[model samples]
Target: MPVQTRVVYQVNPSMVNALKTIREQAYNASRGVINQRVRIQTVDGQIYEGVVVNVDRRHVYLTVPAMQGYGRQWDEDLILTLVLYELLVITLLYI
Candidate 1:
């Protein structure tokens, strides 16, 4: 069987300049979308599309999709928590 893979990014919370644009976007998007759909690409080359479940000062939590037949139960490993600074772009269609 082929091994499954998922890209994850980790960085510091003080990524002000680096993540400034994204932070603002996240804030605006959160109020508008609030668990609606989102598309995010990161420096690590991960492409994710999911609901914007939560957003904090330095991280955004996307409810992991069942792309590989995984059930709805999401453990920590399943959640795609993108570090704000490491994200290249985040697009929310419904926002």
Candidate 2:
């Protein structure tokens, strides 16, 4: 017998709207509900997946559970370059 493997791809933004909508409908919504799953590709074309824990109109903040090369959570100073997913939606913070 031979081993077999298959791969599946998902467009990360597909869930962004839903997450935003949920946040909008919640009474206790805070800046944190902006969290969403995003797919990021590095300069070398490697892919990574994690939560977009924060977002602004121009950029996204990712809490990546994994990092390549270092193979673990990176130090605070080194995290800036590893993720590159653009924010797909904008939500206002509760007043």
Worst 10 residues of 1 by lDDT: 68-77
Instruction: Show where candidate 2 strays beyond 4 Å.
Output: 1-33, 42-46, 66-95
Model 2: residue 11 alpha-carbon error in angstroms = 30
Candidate 1 Cα outliers beyond 4 Å, as residue runs = 1-32, 69-77
Per-residue lDDT, model 1, residue 28, is 60
Give the TM-score comparing model 1 with the true structure, all chains together: 0.55
Model 1 residue 74 lDDT score: 42
In terms of TM-score, the best-performing candidate is 1
lDDT of 2: 0.46
Q: Write out the backbone clash pairs for model 1.
A: none
Q: Could you give candidate 1's per-residue lDDT for residues 1-95 as a string of tens digits?
A: 99998769756768755568767665565546557787888889988888888877777788865555445554343567777666666777664
Clashes found in each candidate (C-alpha, N, C closer than 3 A): 0, 0
Model 1 global lDDT (CA atoms, 0 to 1): 0.71
